[model samples]
Target: MKKTRNTQKQDYVIDILTNAKHTMSVEAILKAMPIKVNKTTVYRILERFAEKGKVHFVTGEDGKAYYALCNDCNVKHEMHNHIHFQCKSCKKVTCLPYEIEVPELKDFEVQETQFLMIGICDMCIS
Candidate 1:
């Protein structure tokens, strides 16, 4: 298998997501980037990553998308059966480690599921 090389901007974006403590929005990613990258470029990279199963995104309560690196995903299959929590006070999104069982639907196909819980995080409570 030939592993394609990543561009400078792509490398930067991956590094930022890899080191992030929680999921980040596109705007937040752009702000954290050291080099100048346009919005379209960031969106493109993130989309590609998601397609390749390297990253995943969740829609927050504010209707904004937040991205985070995938822990156990691959190009063949991407499974995210966990909860996504957003801190209302800090406005940070995190992929909780807990897993939830998806109920079987009769004569219906379930492709994906997202469970978003909005509340004040521990940091804000302290």
Candidate 2:
């Protein structure tokens, strides 16, 4: 079977997110990714990823939006809620602010949260 643009984009979205060392904007994705697709393709791909609970999306303090792969490679993706760290220097994105225990809500379920910490990464330390 072959993948439609949607599937390819969705898969590519995760591939990009997981492979990326840092959180990336749509522009970054479009530029760095080899796929010769358009923005709409990226958006739909992201929507589906969000639908299946494969990845987490968050807006940074700078008002720029970004995405990250759920850090729980060993566990089910939905079970993880940790955020990503974007290093300002090398622009590497790593999962940080490790998972912490939190009380569960009764009414609404907690799906996921994307918290991005932007600063100079260890590689940038001089």
> Taking the tens digit of each residue's C-alpha lDDT, what string does model 2 give over 1-126?
987876776667778887887667788888877778898788777767767767666776667677666554554465555656777777666667676554588898876655567888788887
Clashing pairs in 1: none
The 10-residue segment of model 1 with minimum total lDDT is 71-80
Q: Which residue pairs in candidate 2 collide?
A: 21-93, 22-92, 22-93
Off by over 4 Å in 1: 1-6, 73-77
TM for candidate 2 is 0.69
Q: What is the TM-score of each candidate against the true structure?
A: 0.87, 0.69
Candidate 2 runs further than 4 Å off: 71-80, 90-92, 105-112
Candidate closest to the true structure, highest lDDT: 1
